[model samples]
Target: MARPTVFLIQIFAIFGFLHLGFGAPISLENPLLRQELDKVGELPGQNFVVNFTHYSGYVTVNEDSGRALFYWFFEAVEDSSDKPLVLWLNGGPGCSSIAFGEAIEIGPLLINADGKSLRWNPYSWNEVANVLFLDSPVGVGFSYSNTSSDLMNNGDKRTAEDSLVFLLKWLERFPQFKGRDFYITGESYGGHYIPQLSQAIVRNNLLSKEKSINLKGYMVGNALFDDHYDHVGVFEFLWSTGLISDQTFKQLNQVCANQSFVHPSESCDEVLEMVDKEIGNIDPYSIFTPPCSDLSSNRLRSRMHRIGRVGERYDPCTEKHAVAYFNLPEVQQALHVDPKYAPSKWDTCSDFVNLNWKDSAGSVLDIYRELIQAGLRIWVFSGDTDSILPITSTRYSIDALNLPVIGHWRAWYDNDQVGGWIQEYEGLNLVSVRGAGHEVPLHKPKQALQLIKAFLAGNALPALQLHSDT
Candidate 1:
């Protein structure tokens, strides 16, 4: 394929996958639009030196519905062409990965305290892999739909289908990434997105005469998986950590047992609401971290509440900075956002999408089983300080798999200090990030970087030293 240096695309994702019929491409390419439109140079109020390549734009997944997913891609600091491609999504079932993943977690820079300025992130994930941040499922961040109806009717299956389609179209835009090793990564609700999308990719590859995505494996941290196990573990951690009284814990267990994360029983909701009042103004997602504000007492914003955007629920104030930065006309223009298509105001998460989330799998454990059997590199990590999707819950969820142990459980080290604990299973691995919260990278970026590097290399976390100053 010739490099059409003169053209950039507003990708209308015509191609389909995973139970959707494939459509022929339409001749709607705009040759006058240069790829420079997508290349992000210095951003508005950027104070740090720009050193590497990054681009932000949209990939239209449904032309008929005018639905497009926004993405931000960053090349590795060095030897970018050789690094594996890693796609990062943030869960919520409706959250903006740009807001959480790129703005604060692992993107090249952090939105500064001033809300409009930027500073360097020494621990950005792009240092290791060619990172891609996607605002998926339409109506997320800069991603939008001309058809308002599309926003209300989104679910796991369509999200996966649209995402796979987005990937297919996006690969066309940057043909250089064609066969590079790719991995899907996210957390919270991504317990469903990652596995389901991986299933779509695997099945799609099996169907393609020539293989498409060079999918190696994936990793998820502080993820949501089993409904029963996850729900049970959240309460147990609260009880063990003394966040809830023993009597309250017993009451919760009695009332909330068998309650689905998405649809709790009336008794369960009443008990949870009571417990929310019990926890007070502290962030449930990161128990030890001082919450930036007290906006969530009315309704616990954590997944413990009806909302699924657990990862960023605790981060009310921090996200405001991102929202301010991304919403700026200059910032959006710099990122090539078409104002006509973008929302009047940029938001970090969408309540409408969450409220209308049509389908959510109760457990991705079966998909996990299938992927593990397919020999995908699967690892699940947890932040020990998180009460929402606590490490205990992740352990219980993974334990339900009942796989044989390959590597014994032990402590892992980073910089002569205990970073976390780890255990390797026959087909999957589990890790617990010490002293970290729900958003592992936001709280412990150095450790998160080490974890990502290990995951990309398929190596275990660094072993503890024989003799250490403990």
Candidate 2:
């Protein structure tokens, strides 16, 4: 059993910005801060030694609604200032980027299997760039709203608007990053979040050149590109992969063909029930991997299973650990989380936020088209094992874009092994992480790092072997 680390640290004025002993200079003059800033002195069950700095705090996005979005910042392991800043968001329309993106996936630390301690991850993206993980929209993770109504009225428009506000105010707190090269990345529904947020950033930069975010481009993985094609691709993947029966696939195509995957009709639901039977006990997130022990209940037999479970190498159970550690009073106190604002318990994804999510758009394809036209680096990646949002789904949407293939498809390598496959379109890139699941980083960290490195550098994925130098 792992125990929380107990330590004494300097406390700045309550909720006012407090430096976490990072050598970074602070002006403290930024009026955007209302309460004292919160800093994580140490996390509970973190026994591994680390040299990089981490901070946890809230930025008030809506003062009247008391809506504050929580964020955790990790400076790069090397010369921190020179590195580009990357903002990561996890999609649920309501998931905690901190809990999923940071703690369990590509962040510097990994929660131990005991669900009580921490370990360092060699593949943390922060090794190459400064990373910020945010739990956005009110009522998700440590992010909260004083007004109850705020929780029930969330959609892509509001989320994008509030997130843009959070970014502006956050920059005010850490002014050093004001003109730094900035990039946004996310996964799953993040396919929706990243584009919408990027659109806002682009518009803001155009409106006022003086106070513009140095927006570069964005990448989304295992994302929901378009509802119609996602529906089409999922059924195609299921049938083609032999995960579903011929009859079941045919019926699903006919019954649920023209419905929203997020909220399908009764007929669609029934067809999906047949899909459930065909999928049987397989993990929907990573069809070939064994699901965590907690997922074997008969109650989940025929329901849509979210892509969250532990693998043999990476503990899918890390979510449970994060909830326990973050909810600890001592840990919360050290992070400057005011008890009143914190949830009764932290969750990886919020049902309240998802339930109230008002999806107004049918497809973000138009947004992709706009961003591609804006000359921003756009990359879309998919984990081959994700059944819910399979690679086939991604291909369908990409094909719809009708972009000419600039770089023909080729297998990319990592550590002299086939990492995945990649193909560059005229303005975009589509990648598939071979043998990886819905959460690519969680299952294949090294390859995920390779993918990001290539994306950030605007270079093609490394070829397996350069042809003979004749």
Candidate 3:
């Protein structure tokens, strides 16, 4: 299935819910959402349902076609006195925020190993600021659209626009949040997601005062910011780590430095070819490699079976147990998804193919440049172990930006132990989490949280300085 088609399926599902009052009251009782929240334990001094009641659902973005568009999920705790509103999106160009919400970071709950129960994350982001996790672009998670055509081609532009609409309406729904400090945050492709959406918010704010949205800053973890540098860095990392032989490394370096490096398509081809030739000889667990054709097929089948088995009970984008637990009939009825599709799987990263997107605007670098020029704060972070988009690539990509350095490179320490390295350039902050792979939060939660907290506070995290070893 094409990217657009996959998106359409999500839109159709969302619209079906909208027809049912956008699953409003029922969503409060949604089995999946409620179960996850319940497991996390109730707020410090408040009833569980009372805290959940702060969340409201309605069509945030309405197309000219009159189809009601809705985004569902919980709201961040706010004093209604003073606090910043932070909007969060998870990548996949198709993943839902709920994955990040319930499992990692901060929501009200955490899914257990069994995937059926939840527990509260005492250190959830809400402890500091109000956070909003959104299922976006119509077909992701609980957010949906009535018209298939309304589904974006899954490009950066459309995703940004749709998110903007959701943000505007979300603000309207909670008028108390207006004039409050606001920010955008996400992971993975969200590196691109948050910036694009922030730029759009800035543009709309500049055009009409009444329609303006206040966007403070943005943050991304293990983000895919620049394709050119990111790709080259991946190979360089492989070479440095001895994943590729001296001969293969030399060949790759020559072509990358001279030819393919400047061209994304050529570079991608070269990298894939090199990976194909050497992957079998290398340790799969040690270095991150793209999905080989054979492995890709197996992974695809597994994903499909997982998705098919879950049906509509829950999203099947994450892992298997996650699907079963979140899809229980009790969970579905509470989440407000049709009970018929109840007990279905929930995919945080499903391989729904019908909706592959092909019309994304230029490379991520192009979008990053646009956002920076538009005066939005951009942050790109990486987990060093991630072979898919390793720290080496992220470093190389940022180096190519040629932006003025606001802060020199420094080591990030944890409990007095060296944790990672970070640098600040103009309005953009770049950092690498030591000992972490693709998922920074999952692998290094404390470090990840500390870095984020400092970023949000608009202060520099402690810099790593060279240590003298005698």
Quantify all predictions' global Cα lDDT against the true fold. Answer: 0.81, 0.80, 0.57
What lDDT tens digits, residue by residue, belong to model 2 across residues 1-470? Answer: 33112221123333334343555533345432221344455577777667877777888999998999988889899999999999998887678898889888899987776666778899999988999999978888899999999998888899999999999988877878889989999898888889999999998988886644898899999888787898799889889889999999889889876776556788888778778777777667777877666645532222232323333334545667777777778877767687889888777778777767776456899999999998899999998988878899899999999999999899888857888999999999999999998889998998999888988888888786555657
Q: How many residue pairs clash in model 3?
A: 46
Ten contiguous residues minimizing lDDT sum, candidate 1: 12-21
Instruction: Return the TM-score for each candidate structure.
Output: 0.90, 0.90, 0.73
Order of all candidates by TM-score, from best down to worst? 2, 1, 3
lDDT of 3 at 217: 76
- Spell out the clash pairs found in candidate 2: 14-36, 15-35, 15-36, 15-37, 16-35, 16-36, 16-37, 17-37, 310-316
**CA RMSD (A), model 3:** 9.8
Off by over 4 Å in 3: 1-60, 63-81, 149-152, 210-212, 246-277, 280-318, 338-345, 353-355, 463-470
Report RMSD (Å) for each prediction in the order shown.
Answer: 5.7, 5.0, 9.8
Clashes (N, CA, C under 3 Å) per candidate: 0, 9, 46
